[model samples]
Target chain A: MNAIIEVQDVSKSYGGVVANKRVSMTVQAGGITGLIGPNGSGKTTLFNSIVGYHPIDSGSIKFEGREISKMPVQSIARLGLIRTFQQTRIYAAMDCTQNMLISLPHRKMKFLDAFSKHGESDHAKAERLLEFVGLYEKRFLNAGSLSFGQQKLLEFAMALMNEPTGLLLDEPTAGINPTLINGLIDRLKRANREFGITLFIIEHNMRVIMNMADKIYCLAHGEMLAQGTPQEIQNDQRVVDAYLGTH
Target chain B: MNTKNIIFYVALLVLTAIAPFLFPDFRTQLATLWLMIVVAMTWDMTGGQMGYNSLGNILFYGTGMYVAAVISIGMVHDVGAYTDAGRLELMTFTERQYFVGAIVGIIGAGLFCSVTAIVVGYVTFGLRGPYFAIGTLGVAIAAGELVSNWGWIGGGQGISLPVYPGNFDVGKLFFYYLFAGTGVVLFMFLKWLYSTRFGAAINAIRDDEEKAEAMGIHTMRYKLTTWAMAAFFVGIVGGISGFQLIHFEPLETAYQTTNLGIFMVVCVLLGGKGTLWGPVIGAILFHFIKEVTWNYFLGWQWVALGALIVVTVVYFQDGVMGWLAHRKPQSPRL
Candidate 1:
């Protein structure tokens, strides 16, 4: 399989503290990769660096063989790599469909088009995405009025609106109800399998990481502790010690 | 478009257009009122809708007025003299020049404001909250001082357009219709803008800048766009007002103190900040209050206004429109 995203010896530091220390990883196309870490384990820093949210002190990030280590977040996004916030980011005043539509790639309408009597074909696509995320019923409802889990679902739908090739989800299931996590995971898996989109997930939930991740990279204290299959990661002493001991 | 809303706007426009014919002398007065509404609404675009809280809207307005005045005066002077015999003086150069000058001035104001906004955005958008607001105010003050010291256009005293060789009432009537039309167009444009994808991104950035960046929304671009749009309309309105009044005094145009700026901000805040209709409603209400209560209250009018502001801030944090929105739903539930 082609490597969709490759991060090589990426490092970032703030003042005296190192947020990411020479971390390296590769996300293969058409697979679900998980970055598992305890609190303050540099997962978010690594995510930021790879996604070009923060400038890395060293190392390079390549997306589809192009060096994008210095590209701006919007440019990186335009190149078919998209990220979602751990906390929901949505237009609260807008309806759910409107939220999804805002993220659509090519909005052909001009300033006056909104007032004129015209409709975009993207409306159908927006509705379909909403339906796919199980948010079709609430399409007309204000996005802010939805529950936390539903908001997560809406965010997922929004990320896919640009028809991204790769998605980086920051704690996709965090604060979500236990029952809904399975549905969220299943939908993500289907998106991967059916749409051929790669996903890199940063998750603290062991159940989610273990069940969904093909491979997991464990980080502790700004360094990677281990990289292995889910079963192997579960049995690894270093992983256990990092999670249970001082991290 | 919702049919009811469309019908409502059309009816309002028709009524406004016909009001002059009905009332005759009231045209110029209503036109000035319309111009104030336009300026206030444009200010709301940046301060209220996008939550930038700018106090520099007067900068654009002042510049616009000067630009229009200079162009009209220059053009009219160039063509106003022809004393030779046997020629039918088609239209006095002053009349033709003023007409052309108004168009040029409007365009110049928009361009100037947009460019200035870009520079200001670059400088101050990096600052957050009150710092940003203060930065914009400082920029406006500095700009005003620069214009005052420059002796090209009547220095600090001001420039006056030579009276057009036509009936003054006709000229006033023309200006009234022009500004009124512009006010309607700008309001509708702003309303449409706030409903767009770009506007959505702006609101998201306003709510949480970091999260918006994470979602791949370019916050800087949205900020610059909002600044430009706000500046464009402010400049145009300022230019037209200056042309109609035929004067461009720096201190008066730039609003030397915060009086007019504060009044416009108060209007937006009192009516409701982010709502499309908030600023217009606020402008009309504010003007009515000033006209009705100022004579009776005299020196205490400002004090009363202050008290009203305090009550609004305390009780109606989201402004009157927000309070109404909150009240409307509860009635059905009750």
Candidate 2:
């Protein structure tokens, strides 16, 4: 598979403290790639840098073989690289359908198209997405009224509205219940298999990372500790030492 | 629409429209009051809904008033000379000029405000909480000073619009209705926007800008858009206000910078920031209190308003909407 996103020697510092120290990674096209690390392990920092949410101190980022390290967040998004927050970011007052509709690019609608027609299309897309995530029944309900797990699912579905080529999910199942985690995993898998979209996930859940990731990279102290298939990573001495003490 | 809500809006609009007809003497005065409410609602669009806390709204209002005054005055003076016969001068040059200028001015103001917002966003968007508020306040002060010093458009003394030859009362009434109609249309448009996808993005931005950006929202673009919308309406309103008063003085226009802007902010805070009807309700109530209490109590009216603001902030942390929202019980979990 072709490398869709390439990060080369990227470093980021916040004042005196370094968040990402010369981090480099390649995300392949059309598969679920995982980055597993403990808290403050620079996984999120790296994700931010790649998506242009944070400026890099040095090095380059290439998406579709074009440099995007200095590109604005909106332009980068237009290029089909999208991301979701670790925290659920949704319009609390808006219904679930409205939340999904906002992510659809403005270019899709012509100026003469009546707003009601736009609303209809938005409603249809929102319903379809909600159904995919099993939140269809709550489409009309305020997003804020939904449970935390459901909000996470809504965030996922909203991100997919733009039809992104690569998704940067920061802990898709982080705070969700075990029952919903299964559903979250299923939907994510379907997004990859059915939609043929590439994914780069930063997760702390071992089961989730192992079960869903085609390849996994481990990070510790803003540096790569280990990278391989699930079995290889599980048996790696460095990975084991980083997760469980020096024993 | 629900019958009750529809009835409420219809009744409200009818009362407002017929108010002047019933009380012709106070027609112009009443419309001006409602125009102020519209200005307050415009402020709420950015400061309340988007959580931007912009104090530079006066900038747009002032610009609008000047633009409208300049166009109307320029038109009447230039065209009045040619119309010997009372045939309602066919699109006088000044009228045409004024229209072009007003459109250009509105667009220019929108662009200017958007750019200002973009710069402010880049600088302060990273700063969360109180720092963000301070940053916006600083921008307002700086922009206000810059505009005030620019001497071309009456600088500090201000410009006087050309007095039309028609009956002053009728002319004033016409201006009043024009502003009143504009306010109603603007209010409706904003209400519609509040229910759309753009509104969702704005709400998300308010809740958490960083989170919204992470959700691939292009938060900066949304901020700029809100700023432009606010500027466009405020500028047009400002222009009409100047034309009504027949003065385009910066200090008079900029008078809005201090008193009216703060008043609107207070209105939004007291009523509720993000709710659609909150600012309008707040503006009307605040205006009524000012008119009634000040008329009666003289000198101490401001004190009452201050006290009310303090009490509302303390008790109704979410403002009136929160209080009302809390009164409704939540549905029991199944």
Cα deviation of A139, candidate 2, in Å: 3.4
What's the C-alpha lDDT at position B144 in model 1?
A: 81
lDDT of 1 by residue, A1-247 (tens): 8899999998899989998898888999889999997889899899888778878999989999999999978778767888888877777776798777667653233444433421476788889889998999999888999998899899999888868889999999998999888988899998888877799999988999898889889989998889989999999999998988844
Model 1: lDDT to the true structure? 0.78
Cα deviation at B304, candidate 2, in Å, is: 2.3
For model 2 chain B, the run of ten residues with the poorest summed lDDT:
B78-87
Residue-wise C-alpha lDDT for candidate 2, range B141-175, written one tens digit per residue: 66556656755445556665545336777776766
- Model 2 over residues A86-195: C-alpha lDDT tens digits? 98777777678877777675434443232333466667887898899989999989899999888989889988887888999999998899988887888899999998
- The residue-level lDDT of candidate 1 at B253 comes to 57
For model 1, report the TM-score of its A chain. 0.93
At residue B88, give the lDDT of candidate 1: 67
Clashing pairs in 2: B64-B235, B64-B238, B64-B239, B65-B238, B65-B239, B75-B94, B158-B249
